[model samples]
Target: MSVVKMKLNGKAVSGDVEARTLLVDFIRQYQGMTGTHVGCDTSQCGACVVHVNGKAIKSCTTLAVACEGAEVTTVEGLAKGGDLHAMQAAFKEHHGLQCGFCTPGMIMSAIDIVKRNGKNVSEDVIRRELSGNICRCTGYHNIVKAVQAGAANM
Candidate 1:
């Protein structure tokens, strides 16, 4: 087992994990943070998306040991106090989610998109950037709207 330490959601966290342990496994199993969902285990699905050092990445494919000393932010870290993050609020306000399985990752990725593209991101750009995240229920119309609106608020 390898001992990995990092700042998780602004808090220092450490745990022993196998060398092959995925970051998602370390977060869900060791750190007990289930917000970062494990959808495909492979990198195809964006459900395991999380911010590593302020950049979005698929936690399922990333090794826990590779994240040592990095600052990780899961969906649970988006909100401050009890208020929702701008993206989360936009998702709720725009009805972006239906089944909700992909909401967390979608929000995380949307935040990253806005951060990179700025608040005035266009619809075409939002849709293009959201290609990685898949939502079977909403068909992405609402999700696109949510991302655009969230970008404005960000």
Candidate 2:
């Protein structure tokens, strides 16, 4: 076994994992956090999205050891002092979610989108950028609205 260490959600954490352990597994199993979903084992879905060093990436395809010493942020890390992150709140306010399975990844990906595209991101840009995230519910109309509102608040 190898020791992997990283700053997760602003807190330093370390865990023993094999070289083949995926970041999603490490987050859900070793770290005991289940907010990061595993919609598909493959990278086709963005449900396993997480922030590594302040950038969004698919955790299901990333090795846990590859993120050693990196700053990783899962969906669970977005809240602080019992308040939801702007994106999460926006999702709730805009009814961006239905089943809630894809909500976490959508919020994380949306935050990253705003970080790269700025607060005034367009609907087309949001739809294009979120292509990797597959949402079977809600048809993305409200999700786009939530992302824009969240970006403005962020």
**How does each model score on lDDT?**
0.93, 0.94
Model 2, residue pairs in steric clash = none
Deviation in angstroms for 86 in model 1? 0.6
- Cα lDDT tens digits for candidate 1, 1-154: 9799999999999998899999999999998999889888778779999999999999988999999999999999989999999999999999999989999999999999999999999999888888888787879999999999999998
Over 4 Å off, model 2: none
Q: Mind giving the per-residue lDDT tens digits that candidate 2 earns over 13-65?
A: 99999999999999999999999999988998899999999999999999999
User: In candidate 1, which residue ranges exceed 4 Å CA deviation?
Assistant: none
TM-score of 1: 0.98
